[model samples]
Target: MCFGPFKRVCHWGPLVALGIIKAITFSTVTCLSQWWPPQQSASGTLVFVAFSSSAVLTLYFFLQAMFTGPGVLPAGWRPEVEGDTRYLQYQKH
Candidate 1:
């Protein structure tokens, strides 16, 4: 079977979306850092907050992509699973 134009477009759509997400995330983190003084503690805190927040957001995107659908996540981001499935268990809402 042949995939045709749609296959190619779909393949690149995620990457483009991911790029956009990264840019936005970076900008947001940078802006947030200004709220803290430029001391060593502030720098460290900024790093920690940015990394942790990014990880959480990325995970959310991945979950949305899966159980919900691909478009649930930003274009390029994808979710990953590992271990005893603890990462996937959801609390009943």
Candidate 2:
């Protein structure tokens, strides 16, 4: 994916996720009774800002992780020795 709104994704996972997110957002907006018939937009503006910010941030991180590799894992999670089945045992969920 490119770093832009018109970014293209080779795989379908992120695209599906993005579509789901948008659908949920629109559904939420429509389900809110106060969303329409707004006497004043100040409160609505605040709500919109809060919600849009959350969505944007979520999308940002989602795309970031998808495009960039999932970054690095912390050290010590992997056993240094080969065939180290010991570390795999007793992992606390």
Candidate 3:
């Protein structure tokens, strides 16, 4: 369980798992780079691959969060009662 910006409950397990995976991937890349000759082009390629992979993962997580339904609302929640529906906006559509 996680509390979002507005104190709404959210299932953040997947996000946490993604973060861990990202960290592990980065560490593995760093280790692999250390095994390669620093002056070699392969070393540069490894670095680029590491960064690109991280970037792709970041984008994937961003899209996943953006597309996931709104987080859990409080018990007996109602947008009209909350009175913020008029000001609410979604960038995607």
Tell me the spans in candidate 2 whose CA falls farther than 4 Å from its real position. Answer: 1-8, 31-41, 72-93
lDDT of 1 by residue, 26-90 (tens): 77667656665446586768775777687578957754663353334354443564454565434
Q: Regarding lDDT, does 1 or 2 come out ahead?
A: 2
Native-to-model Cα distance after best TM-score fit, residue 36 in candidate 2, in Å? 5.9
lDDT of 2 by residue, 1-93 (tens): 465543546457777988998898777666543653234666776676677788788878877776675355565667778688565645365
Enumerate residue pairs that collide in model 2: none
Q: Which pairs of residues clash in candidate 1, taking residues 3 or more apart in a chain or in different chains?
A: 14-75, 14-76, 18-76
Instruction: Supply the global lDDT for candidate 1.
Output: 0.59
Q: TM-score of the candidate numbered 1?
A: 0.38
> Against the true structure, whose lDDT is highest?
2
TM-score of each: 0.38, 0.55, 0.38
Q: For candidate 3, lDDT tens digit of each residue in 58-81?
A: 768765665577685665555765
